[model samples]
Target: MYSSRNMCLKWLLLLLIAVAGGAVAAASSAVRRDGGVTYDRRSLIIAGRRKLLFSGSIHYPRSTPDMWTSLIAKAKEGGLNTIDTYVFWNVHEPQPGQYDFSGRADIVRFIKEIQAQGLYTILRIGPFIQAEWTYGGLPFWLREVPGIVFRTDNEPYKFYMQNFTTKIVDLMKSEKLFASQGGPIVLSQIENEYQNVEKAFNEAGARYVLWAAKMAVGLNTGVPWVMCKQDDAPDPVINACNGRSCAETFVGPNSPNKPAIWTENWTHLYDLYGNATRIYKPEYIAYQVALFIAKLNGSFINYYMYHGGTNFGRTTSAFTLTSYYDPAPLDEYGLINEPLWGHLRELHAAVQNCSDTLLYGQQTNYSLGPLQRAYVYSGDERKCAAFLVNADRNNTDIKFQNRTYRLPAESISILPDCNIVSFNTAKVAAKCTERIRVPTMKFDSPMLWQEWREVIPVFDSTTLRSNLLLEQMNTTKDTSDYLWYTAEYEVPADAKAEIKIGSRGHVLRAYINGRLVGSAHGYFRNFSFTLDTTVLFHRGVNTISLLSIMVGMPDSGAYLESRAAGLVNVNVLGNQGSKNLTDKYPWGYQVGLVGERVQIYSMNGSSKVPWSKYTISPNQLTWYKAIFDAPGGSDPVAINLNSMRKGQVWINGQGIGRYWISFPKPDGMPSQTWLHIPRSFLKPRGNMLVLFEEEMGNPLGISIGTVYLKKLCNRYNSYPFLGFSSTRRS
Candidate 1:
């Protein structure tokens, strides 16, 4: 009886043990299935724990695919754990119903490359990305959509925005790119800085933000969504702050429940055409980051452009220079910007050391003095971390917790143990300077040139019409930049006539009887100019042709379609009564320059076209071509357009960028003159350099050269601004 009772008890125990084992196995699977990222009020939680994320913005389209992996690896080595990028709508869907995702536009390949390096991604899928891109990254075709209003609660705009967003989200879903699908993408952004200008659209803007948040949440990507610079962002959409001093502002007023996330800590200012280079101090940037980590209870900080690559092609804003180098850690050529890069790396490391204490500890703040403060975070067992900040222009020593600490002006000091100072923003722990070695070509070896004439099309009575168009964009639809306004008027005798032209465009060149009269251009706005010249008008009729050129179309603002370009109105003041020729007489309109129609700059069908060996003066509109041996090796090339006036340069068949040497320099621009040319675009034997000189410039001074790293220098005087230097004659 005792043996039977013992056997029954053993079987019961065995059955209970089997059931517990199965239950444990099921819980493990459930945890694995719930893999993804989430955030609390304190920090971002990943794998069921808080994670410290340092991300950098490196737009995939800005740099080549071959450079993506190396750039990302460099970022990771610099202690970055995530890569942030914006999905450029203009590059992907250039035309309606057509898409291109190959080569530089292959965003999937870029994200996968980031994942391969074990780095997370912040997908800023803003269909309206305004990163100094042409038309602010909105497709040019959108202008044709009837009854369309951009970035507001408009049916047409919302329809297209939703379509594109859905398309992109579906693509990522198919590739399993979201974090929920065991992929690298952790955060997604919907709108970009919409709050700043939302008031312009009034009630529609508020409705648009709510609609966008709802639409983003509806996508169900299984990751938290962010609305950068949107203070009034609704629930489920995290409102992230932007700008240089984001830490000082925190996460704005409404979204206090969300974790503080700095979406864009501006490393440096963007370069504008005809402006001086803006240099930002590395120490200042370091201090900002350290202060942010010490003050804000957050886990993520992203640099606006850790690597501000080249604009390449016509992707740049109308007012922006060709080189999109924002004085970032990595320049346009993918070279390390020394102290800024290294110093920031050290700062990131120091912040990461105390991340745990910062995320989990209770925080206490104390005011040391005016513009000075101390913050302490204490965890379990009295383990503490501290941040000492001095925002004054002069250094100061302050006593905190019975210990004295010296803080540099406009700097922050991080104490991981609340005692030992592990890092200080003002100290130069890394290389403080960098020198660039640029290879100069022998001045004696001047490039030989061939010339071609751009035939100006004459508008006869047959093509003439009596109506001036409201704007160039509406008439030309952005197909060309040059527009000719030709009109004929009869004069009693040879008399002085004042040809008045009120133009909103950038440049205006006047011609009488096919002869150049005078030229005038505006600085930033439209201005009226009068040409008072003696004209030899024939008894029958005299021809007057006014050529108007647009630097770039209006890229932003409301009712951009209504903005006028070219001659708004023209008036002729002579011995007779002044006549208003604003859409009155037979005004002939020409779309583009004759050279563009013939593809003269591209060297296509050059064998059949007539060529001249004699060099012509740069006073008139002309096309200059030169055949020279390519600068050998893998070094990037740049043409010194120091002497060339305002125009465009083309290497082989690729258009480099627009050059405006005649434009007066804005304060802060360095005296340098070299336009960068990618090595991949050059050939070994024959390379064609074509210049469509508009105003006036000597092409003889043009030279080919290479750029290389020299040595480190102070942050205030980093290598002369990235684009063409103002110094003429190289």
Candidate 2:
């Protein structure tokens, strides 16, 4: 929820004209021209005083660079003076000593875009930011680092984390991006929501937080540093609260020396792939904000995701949806026609009208009735601001200042001058879009289907052979998601045997002697599963190949880095006898899917390999290619992956991440069937679409069309795929 910055927002004109957020303060001890940002017991010191600071999160990597300028502009228009973003370390330093800041990972460019918009910036530099990101935003290669233990007081972990954090701070200093350096950045945050997982690490976690605080403050950013979701964030490092409603629960800072700032007020809540979409009510959000500022004496407020963007590529954690559009005020496509957008814009403006009073006034409270209360901020020159609240489940009459008013249930009313009600949290002019009637899309007929060739991996020298079963992450170092475990074994007689595989997996697919067996996938709670599929084996040398797929890495919990993934154990059990495959290193391992090699997903690369007649065979590694013209409008494009099983997509050689349609949908609203493609990602004609299906899937139902905004990267750059040897029978 945000309103116009500089307070030019004048909505709800019938009630009263809202006051504008003043320009940057001249200069004082609190803030200096040469660049110094300080804070007192009340609020963050910006431009020499505690000004009205309204912020919202818009993670840069979550969206496109082409979309950044437009997204930030919308935040500005919606009354946001500040834009906060987390510097995802995984996006920056993807490898040890190897860093990338190009294209969408260009964070400096993103920050400059915010500066260009004339708004403040809050840089949340978390090497371990767990925003449902892949490996909690830690680079996949961190698990490969020797003597590494994540998030604790481990020396190796701290070394990498601090190194990256300093690199970012130095980068900001070099670019003059901090407010103290005459840049837009006013605050810097280190370590996000550590308290949530702190208890798991025990005293070591406690020590790590202190060290993180000291280390961050030592960076000398000239701005005060903060740690959200840390209760014991140490001296000098301001600890802020993060939750749905900070106004009702957040009392103040842990110490009297700090301001009561809300680092995260979630405007939307996201779920894993199978779960339904959920969000908060706009009116309730407003009421919470009113209570926050009026009752809790709240200072700064930030919406976690003012513009919830997509989890493009393979950036999400295990089982998380590719669509990270959390139903925030701004939809995933940056479309802002939703009622929550307009409603909150007005709400922010109304609260901002009383900013001056709250910042300088002495607070006073009184009981109007049962569960009814009033907070009066009496400031200088008899000027005042007041908030009337009814906390009961049912609306009740409250008398304040000799006037009787009916306060809406669980709502707050704001009076900028302690008189006329300029804004009431319960009374919104907009209608809820839930009850509206509208089809999800204006779909063009399914694109004309064409016959395409397919490729099935032939286990041979192209894959790595080992005498023993290798741990997944260590063997591949997370170079790719798919891994193959193939072994040739003797079977005494023609019989059925259970191929038991204990896989620390998101998915496991098996193939016996070039024939399909079956596949099993893990849910959100458990990514590890044991597969006991029975298959017939002729009395001879039979090849057993098991493919282990990781949806994403473990993001939270203690010692996540040390946790084992992939197929940990393999065996064959039958009435005749039981044979163990893992004990003697009896398998050959392939790091990634054969299609991933030779760039089979690419338009030009697909031609190198001969493709045969199409088959929608289940439990087979397959690739499908097609082309289509770009949709006409700027509306976001949608490609329905309903009929398809689990797989990945690529457009014009760009990987759009993986998809799994087999996961049954609970809510039944299209069931996350469509993968949204940005309009900018498409060309007018001949847009190459490629799919690497892992199982039985029909491309006939696969359609690329346009959907309105209403419903809503890459490793391996340095090293090319080794050698490619193909086995094709025509």
Writing each residue's lDDT as its tens digit, candidate 2 over 630-689 gives 877566677878778787888888767678777765755433666767766778898878
Whole-model lDDT per candidate = 0.74, 0.75
lDDT of candidate 1 vs native? 0.74
TM-score of each: 0.88, 0.89
> Across residues 205-263, which tens digit of lDDT does each residue of candidate 1 receive?
77687778778777878777888888866665778888877666655425444677888
In model 2, how large is the Cα lDDT of residue 725? Answer: 21
Worst 10 residues of 1 by lDDT: 721-730
User: What is model 2's C-alpha RMSD?
Assistant: 12.2
Candidate 2 pairs with clashing backbones: 3-78, 3-79, 4-78, 4-79, 7-21, 35-180, 247-292, 467-585, 468-585, 618-696
Residue 289 miss distance in model 1 (angstroms): 2.1
